[model samples]
Target: MKTTVEQSLRAYLDDKTANGELGPGSRLPTERALVAQLDAPRSAVRRALDTLEGEGVVTRHVGRGTFLTESARAGAEAAPPDTSPVEIMQVRLVIEPPVAMLAARLATQADLDRIVECLQAGGASSTFEDFEAWDAKLHRAIAHAAHNGLLLSMFDVMNTARTLPVWGTLKRRTSTPERRGCYHQEHEAIVGALVDRDPEKAERTMRVHLEHVADNLLGRV
Candidate 1:
């Protein structure tokens, strides 16, 4: 029921009616004509018209086309939303590595304090969910040091799109001291690079760290 065709047609019709091009009791163009005008399918045009008629915004006769009812424009503006997840990751691929670099280049002793806390918490957390929460905090700490509001805003949105459901499986499969120790050691290396204020080294180290995760995700390792 939530067709792009319907949503676009609704907006087009609403705008025309608001500008007095379509008034109450006005018969819209024939369904076939509308399909051509909107570049939508015949089924889409019929569905939009059916919805309009059902809402009393338009009436249909056996031979005549749909007409605009008194309240035709009121409810047409409310349509369901369709958002894409890829749209979010595209932004992350632009922003996060640079944020890690910036945090190393610009972070003061005070700024490093917070990042150190988050890193420590992440390394120590026993539960996968708890570790993930602290890990997110560690990344957010780097974003906070970027000193650019737009980049930070973009980082927040990207963080919301990261959906890795395999962590629980890995947690159970690798439930041993050595596997957990490797994770902690890798994180410590990243934090150590950041603490040394070497942007290039930190960025490369973080990328290598994430590449390990990428390998696991793709089943390449």
Candidate 2:
């Protein structure tokens, strides 16, 4: 029984092979290694390899390692896809909106105070790198104030996704004076809404804040 996990493993391996990194007769890392690297189950890795051999993308000779077919080599050279803006937003969509909702309901006065402090730090930042770090920390503190373990975990995942090269490109292209003013205004609006204990207003304000980020940062939302 092939699971979706197995299919995903197979697809990822195929993609790597297509990029010309896994050449003809290349013996890939062992199943245990892949399982460790992918953080997937042993059965999933074995199943993917079996399916690949069956389809002749790779061949399994008796007592020998798997060998990539010529077609596999040609397929392997597809440039590794750069992560897309939509993918980045999908991550934020999962983590942030709900965190804002939770922060509205759960944040304490001290939590709000801490977030305000972080925002002030961001404002005081003179360099882009420093400001970006504080800006991320401010948002992360808001996520922390949400008081849900799952929300915190999701924020970590989204933060990892945000580190991609496309994000770097967007950061470079955006950030003019008017845009910076609008950003500060929205940040203050969200903080104020949370302080007001207005969950609906907080959520709405947060939605606007993130929408502006998508418009200004990625240009695709």
Top of the candidates by TM-score = 2
Clashes of 2: 6
Residues 1-221 of candidate 2 have per-residue lDDT tens digits of: 55465456656666776686776677777667778877788976665565444333455555666666544433333213465767767667656766877898899887898789867876776655555555666677788789876656556555544445577567756866566657778888888888888788878888888877887765657
User: Least lDDT summed over 10 consecutive residues: which range in candidate 2?
Assistant: 71-80
Off by over 4 Å in 1: 1-94, 163-180, 219-221
TM-score of each predicted structure versus truth: 0.52, 0.60
Can you list the residue pairs that collide in candidate 1?
57-69
Error of 2 at 202 (Å): 1.0
Residue pairs clashing in model 2 are: 17-76, 18-75, 18-76, 18-77, 19-76, 20-76
Off by over 4 Å in 2: 1-82
Local distance difference test, per candidate? 0.63, 0.67
**How does model 1 fare in lDDT?**
0.63
